[model samples]
Target: MNMSTMNSACPGPFVRRHNPCGHRTGQWAQILATTTAQDQEHFLVIYHDSDTELLPAEAPEQHYEFGPAPAYWTE
Candidate 1:
């Protein structure tokens, strides 16, 4: 797959790093499937760690929540 074109929908070229606990960090993982739950779409994601065997079960290193996309600003 093209790495440049990948976005939130695609898992990524993970980096090797260490967490606070000195354990090996996991690859950057994105949602592989989309489903409906809790009155909203469910696409669970996480950063893979050696401790977590499953990608879907891993915990994200960071969680980013943003407001609606902003349009081009004009004065």
Candidate 2:
């Protein structure tokens, strides 16, 4: 299969390193999916500690902060 098809079929997790409020709490999060609720988009993410949180999709860079995972992260 083509790269695009493969990616679409099994998209990699959207990972970020921070809290919902855009603060670095020494945690890494993986965005699982996006859902709409009450006319707003939200992201379903799970932290490295196995804690799940729903974050606003608007201005994701600010709400669900994004950055490289810490060196300790391992898949």
Candidate 3:
């Protein structure tokens, strides 16, 4: 795929650097700024030494309650 383009989808030159750690099926994400919206996707720098965290796109506003559902965050 060609990088450094004028678009909104693939912001900037996004590249994933795979760091091998004596195993497979693990990877990280990194981002390098550039003059393009596609560049934002490259902000997540993945490293082997660092632990990557994945969160939901957006947190649920109203959590359904089921018989005193587990409470947290001052629920």
Candidate 4:
């Protein structure tokens, strides 16, 4: 899925693998932002620990699993 085209105004839940930050590499996070760069999509996300990170929407080492945000994740 091309996340750069996704609606950033309404963030959703996503699971990432092999996170470069080396924390919670395979966990669900809330996507706070999505942007395009060099024809590639990136995602800025916040984890359960409140830690935020910017990751590629797709990469050789990282995998993204996107889904709807949980009920508890509300404004």
Candidate 5:
């Protein structure tokens, strides 16, 4: 996964391959933040351009896996 700095400016849920300094897009999941809730074990996180948007002021870890979903904890 491409490593982008999660900061107030950089924000959460950026395009999987974006430079962060500018608005770019591709066929990728725009990740914002990730939080484990309930007892589910899998890729659980917030995405971009959605209702549950993570504020840019809050830095949060973000990423995405392209291949067939891993065995849950793999992410």
Candidate 6:
């Protein structure tokens, strides 16, 4: 996906990204502010369009791999 940033007359730079699943789907979001909720730091991003939605962000410590797969001839 391609991301673009606008340098308009705003406090923070406006960021926009296109949805990879849809050709004409895209969204623009800006970092409105930052605050701590329940002792966890969070960023407040406002979306200008409804083409996309936001999910709860998480910080994963490390990546784990699934074990080796078994080989089977027939299904």
Best by TM-score: 4
lDDT of 6 by residue, 1-75 (tens): 101221231224333333344232233455454445665543344554433333122221111111122132110
Question: What TM-score does candidate 4 reach?
Answer: 0.56
User: Which candidate number would show the highest lDDT if scored against the true structure?
Assistant: 4
The C-alpha local distance difference test score for the whole of candidate 3 amounts to 0.26
TM-score of each: 0.27, 0.53, 0.19, 0.56, 0.23, 0.34
Stretches of candidate 1 exceeding 4 Å from the true structure: 1-28, 50-75
Q: What digit string (tens of lDDT, one per residue) describes model 4 on residues 1-75?
A: 554345532366554555446556667678776777678776778876798876766652235555676544322
After TM-score superposition, the amount by which residue 37's alpha carbon in candidate 2 deviates from its true location, in angstroms, is 1.8
Query: How close to the true structure is residue 55 of candidate 6, measured as C-alpha lDDT?
Result: 19
RMSD (Å) per prediction: 13.7, 7.0, 14.4, 5.3, 13.6, 16.3
Pairs that collide in candidate 5 are 13-31, 13-32
Tens digit of per-residue lDDT, candidate 2, span 1-75: 222222311223545534435543445566666666687766677766677776565644443335454565433
Model 6, 1: alpha-carbon shift in Å?
26
Model 1 worst lDDT run, 10 consecutive residues: 66-75
Predicted candidate 1 versus true structure: per-residue lDDT over 1-75, tens digit per residue:
222232443332233222443233323333434444555443343333223222221232332221222232110
Reference-based TM-score, model 6: 0.34
73 in model 4: Cα distance from truth in Å? 10
Checking candidate 6 for backbone clashes, the offending pairs are none
Runs with alpha carbons beyond 4 Å of true place in candidate 3: 6-25, 33-45, 48-75
lDDT of 2 at 69: 43
**Cα lDDT listed for each candidate:** 0.31, 0.52, 0.26, 0.61, 0.30, 0.32
